[model samples]
Target: MRVIAAKEFSDRIRNRWVLAVAAVFAVFALAISYFGGAQQGAVGVQGMEVTIASLVSLVIYLIPLIALMLGFDAVVGERERGSLDLLLSMPLTRFELLLGKFLGLSAALAASTLAGFGLAGAMLVMQWPEGSLWHYAGFMLSALLMGMAFLSMAVAVSVVVADRARASGLAIALWFFFVLVYDLTLLGILVVSEGRLDLDFFPLLLLANPADVFRILNIFSLEEVKTLYGLATVIPEAYTSPWLLAGIMVLWMILPLSLAAWKFK
Candidate 1:
């Protein structure tokens, strides 16, 4: 299993598209820092925080793109290239094979995200920010878990679909829905309903969508800002707790991964 996992990881790392993704992320982070510094009138911790927030904000879009690119063809790509039968003929069980592929793709994403945050953190630390490195680190960890969830969803889509194009299309559409449209639609619903429904259930309802959980996580983590800056105005009362936000994210991470693995068998 370990060997298979290593091979899968290596295969993904070697892909040119993966390298391109790394470059894009690097560029995006640099741009964030440059613009943030310009706007803030100095290069310091606040600038760094802006950079981190920008990068994290980009995750809603980037994470799904990376996952779709990695897994849209996981099975179909192999099958189209006439490698699936050969792979199945190997001694590895379906579970091991799936795990190997998922771990590899996920590791690639994790490494890139962590590297981006690490570089940003070093810059922030050098600037002597009042914030702890631990806070940014926690945010990075959450981003990674969210990335894993996205990857699992992509893999499941790939496995169930027969055509690579269709699979990719489906993955991207789902990404748009969950990461972008779903939240907007939910807000519209709340507005149309005019708060007539219980506002109390919003947080629990939000758990059904991964992006909402992520946003809540970000908002709750910035407690001082929540209190002083009134940033909590956007957050529903039920999602005010970091623990609850974290739990919701965990559910989002686990449910899709489990369903994907089971469906693969």
Candidate 2:
């Protein structure tokens, strides 16, 4: 597993794909961090907490898309290139291969996220100088978790599909459903029901979507952030615990990977 992971990481790094991703992240992070408050007629830094809130929206959209693109071809691409047979003939378990791919891709995602967001975060620190950074730290951690979860889903799709074309299609469709359609569909239902739907189960529905989990984890983690995001009125206080949401995010990462492992075996 270690060897496979190292090879995968080295391959991505050598291709400069990781560097390209890091650059994309860094550019977006800097743009949003510095100008996120322009709509509010403010400029520059805009407090670490406010910057985190702005970046949460950006991360939710971008990270999952990047993760899916990264892992959608992890297995299928190898098979298409006629490398899977060569890989399987070696002295390694399917679990090791699958896990190695996951870990390697996850590490790449983590490195890009940290490097990109870390640079922006440093700028925020330099600009603010007196603000606490724990909230921003939490945002970065949650972003990583969200990326891993989507990457797991993508890898699972790659393993299940017989061809790279199908895997790629499935990956993009998953992104569309989870990141775009899910919330819109839910909102549509709520609107059609005219506020008559049960409120108790709404949180459960939100928790079911990993993107929503990321949003809730960051938005509700801090009271000030919550107010800035305007989720306090809709998201009940009972569902705001950071540890609880983090656990759900973990489950999101594990369950998809477990499915991928089973299919690979």
- The TM-scores of all predictions, comma-separated, are 0.86, 0.95
Q: Per-residue lDDT tens digits of candidate 1, residues 112-175?
A: 7777666656665566466657667777777777777777788778788888888889998988
Per-candidate Cα RMSD to the true structure, in Å, reads 2.8, 1.5
lDDT of 1: 0.70
> Which residue segments of model 2 deviate by more than 4 Å?
129-131
**Which candidate gets the maximum TM-score versus the true structure?**
2
Write down the lDDT that model 2 would get.
0.86
For candidate 2, write residues 1-265 as lDDT tens digits.
9888888788888998888988887788788877888998977667767777778888888999999999999999999999999999999998889889999999988888888888777776777645446777788899999999999999899999999899989999999999999999988988999999887787788888989999998877666767766767777887778888888888988898899889888
* lDDT of each candidate versus the true structure: 0.70, 0.86
